[model samples]
Target: MLKVNKLNKSFGENKVLNDISFELKSGEIGVLLGKSGTGKTTILRCINGLEEFDRGEITVDDISIKNVKDINKIRNKTGMVFQNFNLFPHMSVLENIIQAPISVAKISKEEAVNTAKKLLKLVDLEDKINSYPFELSGGQKQRVAIARACALTPKVLCFDEPTSALDAESIKKVINIINELKNKKIAILIITHDIGFANEIGDKIINI
Candidate 1:
């Protein structure tokens, strides 16, 4: 459901991603494994429309990132979970998850809340619904971020260093959650330095 072909990007004279190509299909987990500064995260940024590439084509579902007049069109088809779990510090967990759906998707507050509840339950954070980002642990925050991303019902999901700050147990939880998402047929792309984690969950591992 996601394709990146001949992708090339550079900052001034320094090239980051060069001719990178990959395809991630529905229900498949594709891992981008590399050391720091290997453009793994850059790839994610390009796919999500956060960074414009110098050359290449990126399409999520059927929407091309470059051709879309509105970037939100491509964004709506993809979900991104950042390494730092970029939750709104001021909003409660339930509010954070429901924000995108109600604001961008134009769903009613009641509908958004219902969807958020189901997502929180999926992430095993139902009881933390009223909690703020500061009140939660690192793992809990990440789970909330995941729920917020899924609230949009994206066709593809991108994760940047999902297991970065978590402990072994938390890593396992994330693995399980990602596995469950795969069953839901959401094309998954994970940018991780953890080779072991990648090997365990990735259907196709790409080294950059």
Candidate 2:
């Protein structure tokens, strides 16, 4: 689903990503494993068009990232989950989940709420939709964040240190959701330091 050709990026005198090249097929879960500061997150950012690379090309399902005329396109097709949940604090759980789809995706509020409720159920957060982010636990918030991402129904998902800040139980819950995504044949790219989680969900591991 993605073809990255001769990707290279540098900053001043430092080169973060050096001639990095790879291809990810549809429905494949690819993992990038490396210690901190090895450019794993940078690679993810570049692929998402949040960071600009000096050279190379990224094509997703035949659409080049360069061809993107706006940020909304990149976001709609490629969803990202961060280590920190990045939830909108001012909004309620349901609003957080429905805002992007209703605003950016231009869907109706009723439709987005309907979709959000279904996603909350999928992530086992049906009862928590009425709560605020501060009212939920870290794990619950992350699960809600995942549900928010799924609200967009992207073709591919990118996770950056998804479970790094979670507790053991929370990690397990998040990983389970990720594994379910793998089973459902959603293209996923995970950047993690956890060896076991990498082994469990990654169909291919690229060490940076």
Candidate 3:
């Protein structure tokens, strides 16, 4: 579960997020909808501890981001999928997926690979396990990124502009993949300017 209460963030004299409040329960999809410069991505960054907020609180599975010591604790339980599909160009799909579990979670390589395979299959990227990032299409790369994020078995998943730079068919695939994750009871948070995409999958829509 994810909860953001009275959140506020600012860059010097410019305030970005103002009293942003929302709660996402297990198996629910929450979308933050707004145009560019509305601090949608900033909220996600604050939730993941990538950015320090000026005020308020973000609780992911009851672990508050406000606590300095618990930052890594919450981050381990959270996964983020960026807009550009941030995959390692030199690393193969299998390697990318297993990296976090092995390095951060301290899981064995054998176990991590097994989990990676399952996640790759979930994202329909099993066949591309040996392929490099450059060899895949945008949609394929996005799926790979999703598989990598899910490899950690995170409690909360955050996606930034998930449907960006994809065709209609690709968007449909993403929708299906997100729905599958939701069925598995992972709390999902997404920020996008696409109203149609939000309406299609979001259980709760928060406007900025």
Candidate 4:
């Protein structure tokens, strides 16, 4: 459902992504694996419209990212889970998950809350519905972030260094949650340096 061809990016004189190319089909998990400076996260940012690439093409379900006017359209089809779980610290878990659905999807508050509850259950955080970010552990926060991403019902989900801050057990839980997403037919792209974790969840790995 997503394709990147001849992708290139730079910061001033420094080139970060060089001729990177890959494709991710529905229900498939793609991993961008490399060292810290390999531009893995840059690729995700480019796909998500958070960064402008100097050259190449990225299409999500045939909608081109190059069309600036349709950036929101592209984003609606793609969900991103950041390296740092970017949850609103003051909002409860349920609120965090429902915000995008209500604001972006234009769903009613009651419906969004119902969807959020289901997502929370999926992430094993149903009991944390009223919990704040500060009250949760790193893994719980990440799971909340995942639920928030899924709230948009995106076709493609991009995770940036998902397991970077988790312990072994927590990493396992996160990986399991990611694995379950494949059944939902969401194309998953994970950018990480953790080879073991990547091998466990990635159907295909793009080395930058």
Candidate 5:
């Protein structure tokens, strides 16, 4: 469902990604691993159209993105979760998820709420619907973030060190949630420092 060829990205003088090439079919669990400064996160941002590349091509489901015109189209097929939860503190959990669908997905408010609730249940957070992001623990907040991402129901789920800030218990819980998503046939790409989890959960690992 995703193809990245000769992808090169640099930040002025620093080169992060060097001719990276990879292909992901539907339902595949792929992992990208490297040192702290490598282009792992940048690669994900590029795929989701958050970071523009210096060169190379990225295709999601045969749709090529080389200009601003295809940015939204490519992003609609991809959901990215950052190391930081990046949740809006002022918004409630349900509001965080529902807003995206109603505004970006263009679904009706009622429809978006219904879908958001179902997603919360998938992440086992149905009871915390009315909770604000600050009201939840790191793991709970991360799960809410995951639920929000899944609410998009994108073709691919890209996670960047999702459990980095969580405790041991929280990390395990997050891993379990990701495993479940993998089983449910969501294409998963994780850029993480958790090598053990990568070995256990990833179908393929690319170490830069």
Candidate 6:
């Protein structure tokens, strides 16, 4: 579960997020819909501890982001899929998926590989295990990114403009992947301007 209360964020004189408040519960998909520069991604960043908020509170599964001594603990529980697939250009798809689990989750390489393979299958990227980011299509790369995020077994997953870089068909694939994730009971937060995509998957839509 994720909750944001009266969340306010600003950069110098510019106020990005204004009293934004919402809650996302397990097995539910929450959508943040607004035009560009409305701080949808900022809300995700603050929740992930990637950006510090000036005011308000964020908690993931009841753990306060502000009070957490080890931010990595919060990050481990919250997985973020960036607008651009932030895959390692040099790493293979399999490698990318396994990296976080082995390094951050302290799982064995053999175990991580096994889990990564399963996740790849879930995202329909098992066939491209050895492929690099450059060799993959936009859809394949996004699937890999999703696989990488799911590898951590996060309680909540945040996707920032997931369909922004894809074609119509690719967008469908990504949406299907997201739809599948709902059955896993993980809270999902999607930040996007794509109303059709949001309506298709969102259990609750929060307009910013």
TM-score of each: 0.96, 0.92, 0.96, 0.96, 0.95, 0.95
Q: By the lDDT metric, which is better: model 2 or model 4? A: 4
Q: Identify the leading candidate in terms of TM-score.
A: 3
Error of 5 at 137 (Å): 0.4
Clashes of each: 0, 0, 0, 0, 0, 0
RMSD to the hidden true structure, all candidates? 1.3, 1.8, 1.1, 1.2, 1.4, 1.4
- Candidate 3 global lDDT: 0.90
Candidate 6 residue runs with Cα over 4 Å from true position: 67-70
User: Model 2 — TM-score against the truth?
Assistant: 0.92
Ranking by TM-score: 3, 1, 4, 6, 5, 2
lDDT score for residue 204 of model 6? 99
Q: Which ten residues in a row have the lowest lDDT in candidate 1?
A: 64-73
TM-score of 4: 0.96
Which window of 10 residues has the lowest lDDT sum in candidate 5? 65-74
Candidate 2 residue-wise lDDT, 97-120, digit = tens: 999998889999999999999888
Q: What is the lDDT of residue 153 in candidate 6?
A: 87
Give a tens-digit lDDT track for model 6, residues 56-134.
7777877765532446657888998988979999899999999989988899999999999899888888889998899
The models' CA-based lDDT, in order, is 0.90, 0.82, 0.90, 0.89, 0.85, 0.87
Model 2 CA deviation exceeding 4 Å by range: 67-73
Candidate no. 6 TM-score: 0.95
Please give, for residues 1-208, the per-residue lDDT of candidate 4 as tens digits: 8999888888999999888889999999998888788788888888888888888878898877654445776888999999998999989999999888898789999999999999998899999999999999999999999999999888899999998899998998888888889988899999988888888899998888
Ranked by TM-score, the better of candidates 4 and 6 is 4
Candidate 5 pairs with clashing backbones: none
TM-score of predicted structure 1: 0.96
In model 6, state the lDDT of residue 48. 77
